[model samples]
Target chain A: MYQLLNHQRKEKLRSPFWTKNILMNILLGFLGLYLIVTALVVSFMAAGFIREEFEGRDVIEVFTAFLFYFFIFDLGFRFLLQQLPALSLQPYLTLPVRKSKLIHYPLLRSISSFFNILPVILVLPFFIMIVCANQTGLYSTIWIATVFSVIITNNFLNFILKKYFVKRPVLILAIFLVAGCLLYFDSIGNAPLSGYFAAAVNAIANLPFLFMIPLIIAALTYYFAYHLLRKNFYPEDSQTTRSRPESYSFLNKYGELGELIGIELKMILRNKRPMSVLIFSILFLAYGFILYDDPDNHFNLMLGGFIMTAAFAVNYGQFLFSWEGSYFDSFMVNRVSSFNYIKTKYILIAFSGFMTFVITLPYAFISYRIGFVNAAMLLFNIGISSVLLLLFSTRNSTSIVLEKSQFLNYQGTGAMQFLMIIPLLGIPLITYIVFLILGIQQYAVFALGAVGFVGIIFYRPLLQIVVNSFVKRKYVMSSNFRKK
Target chain B: MIELNNLKKVYGTKTALSVGQIIIPERDFTGLVGNNGAGKTTMLSLILDLIRPHSGAVTSKGKIVPETDEWKNYTGSYLNEGFLIPFLTPFEFLAFIGSLHGKNSSDVKDFLNKNRDFYTENIDSSKYIRELSAGNKNKIGILAAMLPEPEILILDEPFSNLDPRSQSWLKMKLKSLHLEGVTILISSHDLKHVTEICTRIILLEEGIIIKDTKTSPDTLVELESYFSVQV
Candidate 1:
């Protein structure tokens, strides 16, 4: 087991994904630390906030009532973000290690996931501040133990759910249905399901012996995962099913560039990683609902419009050439010209931005300001931001494995993507803010549109610049991509 | 015609390929033979403009490959599986490759039909290129390279992963293409096949060309004796 763990450590350390770019690793590390600190701060503040919000109710009761909702959210978050612990166990299978130990290796390794730590950070400070401050040490200890066990249970259950039910829509639909019903009942204020959960947790806190219930539940979930995995432990059983071949013959009429774009669209739809990015972009279309609720905040309105229209372009375009890294050699050697290649990517990304803009145009009904801002941002995203993203992508040489899940898979990420965030968001926000300072915020929005219109006019020259950069870097990009 | 002028490539401290000059004339069947790490792939990569040389250039028809995209119009090369898009099926991959060279789907279909004996399975099946066996993948890659009826064809170890029957079929196909005046450049470890088909052979050792000669009846014996000494 120790040897297996050591091998895993070496595997991670030696993976070219991390060893290639120490800067990206450092950036990710800082981002992770920032999130942890933010979670801790939120946890500490929650106690006082709960007391103030529910003035007449018991503080512990309000906190415990919300615990159920938090757990559901945690489960959903894990479903989206938590990567299943996979080790290259075929070699170990032939070795002297026991089969159970081999199974336990991955399961045990999963406990160290950041998802497991996040809940503890979120709950620890709040629990200590509220429950421990008022109650006896024994009572608070039991309460904390119960919450920790629930968290562990959630961690293990998430593995099972993701392993077996992720591809099956029925289980996911059932979970969503139950969550929706609970939320609906709670909103209507009739026998709220959260009230019962809070009462149950309070009862368990008062009775220290009942802490064993959550502990047992956690143990059962772990054992259940173990048994399921042990039953179907062969590596062949874990292979992803082959995707059906798709034809885009209709795109032929649009010429070679259309076919290229069709190929990219197929790549995104058929691959797991790019599909996840597409899903996230679609979800970001709802940004107006959150940011536009406060109609007067023009800064957020501009930010929201930019994000909503350019979500796909920004998320998917950052790793534009990297997506085709696998076949870049073939692409280069073939009759495809670098200029046409760049144009294909530009058209695809900008077209996606245009589609998103039209889809989100209904946000105008909320307010004419929103409509105007979205229109301006849409032009900016397609004309300026998309061009900038394509330019920056030439510097990214990291190759991405399309088959892997996008969640926490940083295969194609480089420092360029992190640096790109500043200019991608900064330009619009800064331009809007400068206009607001001059006391003509409306014209500032109009100015954003004007800049984008100018960019659109000179898009041919901008595309040529991108193509030139790609041409100069093609050898390096092709050689780097060929490494894996 | 392809010309390499003082072409050199280095990886870290080791020079992977260095050639003062080697001009491959039009309609010539040229073979590159070497051991592992002898830089056969590197030389081909430089010629394809797939890798930038240290301080030299490859010019086809007096046009620098890196400086211009004209060579790609008539040149087709596949060095490895990196040339194959794994997500697309063999037919789709061929069609895409064909489309790039102004060939329509029917043209691609005709090419596949002509090479029907080379494929052991259904070429138009839904199986993605990645899911195919190594030999089938190689076949798809080779077929895609030839689909454009390119004037210049470059392949690295085209016979390595092929089955025995497919290998002979490919040999015949190459001979036919050579007869039709298509310029062929291939690198292989199989001396028997290389000597049998190639009119000219270049032996590389440690990034330097050791022998460049036209194939005669005794050339196979001479090459075999040379390799036997390395043991």
Candidate 2:
């Protein structure tokens, strides 16, 4: 299994897409290192704050009391970021290898996962500086063992949770609802749960044998994952049943472009990657509250407006062409005109932006200016940002696998996708800044709106250019989409 | 009729296909037979306008395919799995294709009923194309192409992933469709199947057509011997 996994990794690294952009990799590497360092500094500072907060109380006990919250974040992060272990395990399924070994390969490979490294980075510095320096060898050992146990339990727990999510998504929602109820009782209903949790963590140091509890939890989680993988190893079991017609047929009434938009909507809602992006965009709509809470943070208001309205454009439009990469050839040979095809995409993004602006309308109560600024930004996003996104999207010929994890999984992203950020976010901001420096601060909003309005006015001619580009690149796009 | 006038396609340094002055007469059931990378798929792609030829053009009914949308009104094609939309149900996919050619859901349902044997258990089951078996997915692709009642149908390697029963069913369907005077082009590596169903056979070798002949009773034997010697 190790040999097979190593061979897979080597082959993946050798793929042209992976090695094509050296600059992106280096930038990503530096960004990762910077984040890790920032996390370490933040954790150390948090440790110091804990020391100051509890002057007489045992720092370890106080830390243990807060461990519950840490695990909450850990579990949530693990669920989102952890890559499923068996993505490349399909080829090995038909081989003579044991099923148990095949399943264990991904589980074991996950031990070295970045999810595991992150918690250790946040926890280790404090453990060494505070727990080790202040406690006996036995106390430190038990404390350290407790942390590792929770981390391991969280890891395997994710495996079980994700297995359930794949098999039955409702189970995950039910589990979360139950967890929410428990939190309510502990924090607001004066239940014994919080006391019990702190007791459990502190007992690890007071009674070293209590460390066995977490280990048992980890083992049980691992066992559950093993059974789940064993039961669902075959290809037949993996292909989920479609159950019923989840597509919306009502949109068919709007004629061909409407039907095309309906198909795009179904693609977003049914697929894993696009669905996640849709959910994330909805979640981002609440950012207006965060940014508009303070009037002094007006820059955040403008940025939020731009990002919020163009949320789908930034997230989904980056891979606009690649999203349909699998079936791009069918589009080429079909009777659909390039003009209507590109126009459907335009309506999808612009409609989403318009909807976001409407959703963020209640933020107007903060001040009328806030509402005006956001409206201008929304217009700019729909008119200018979406056009830029579509134009840049034409250059993207990379075929994206819709099944892959969307979080931090940069598969189809190229240098062109990276450059898409320039026009989407950078150009508007630069325009605003230049307008502000010109001493007509109030005109900045109107300037951005004017640019976007100009785009909207010339929508026909602009759409023609985009349509021509798409038609011109059909062959190039088709060939690129065909590549693995 | 479809005409390829000096159609040439190159991928970087390699010339994938370079066919000159080939006219596929209307109502001809032409089979494209070639080894892997022999430009069978590439040629089909060019004819369908899925990829552009570096030089020359493909004209269908006196209009260039890329310049005019008129060819799309009469053409139906399925080159491979790349042409299948995996997110959609088989019914939805076929219905979508039918809608493109001005057929409604009832028309699509009637079309499915006509070729029900090709799909067997898969047609009634509500499963996404991605969840279905490879053979079933291929069935969806072929059915989608046939659903439009097109005048020109192009299929590449239709028998590659199909079960024996499905393969035979498709052969019968193709023969029936051919009898209805629909111009059909098929590419396959299986010489026996090609010779059995196709009225005309074109053998491609190294991106160029080597043999273009009308099929006879001895065509299968001739193709077998030719491949055996080439190997």
Could you estimate the TM-score for every candidate?
0.92, 0.91
Question: Per-residue lDDT for A384 in model 2?
Answer: 81
Q: In lDDT terms, which candidate is top?
A: 1
Reference-based TM-score, model 2: 0.91
User: Model 2: residues >4 Å from true position, as ranges?
Assistant: A1-17, A43-48, A51-57, A65-67, A90-98, A166-200, A365-368
Q: How do the residues B53-119 of candidate 2 rate in per-residue lDDT, one tens digit apiece?
A: 8999999999998889899888888888887788887888887788788888899888888787888
Best by DockQ: 2
lDDT score for candidate 1 against the true structure: 0.86
lDDT of each: 0.86, 0.81
Model 1 misplacement above 4 A = A35-49, A124-145, A164-191, A203-220, A227-232, A240-243, B229-231
Tens digit of per-residue lDDT, candidate 1, span A433-464: 79988998767767888898899899999999
DockQ of each: 0.69, 0.71
CAPRI-style docking class of model 2 based on DockQ:
medium
Pairs clashing within candidate 2 = none
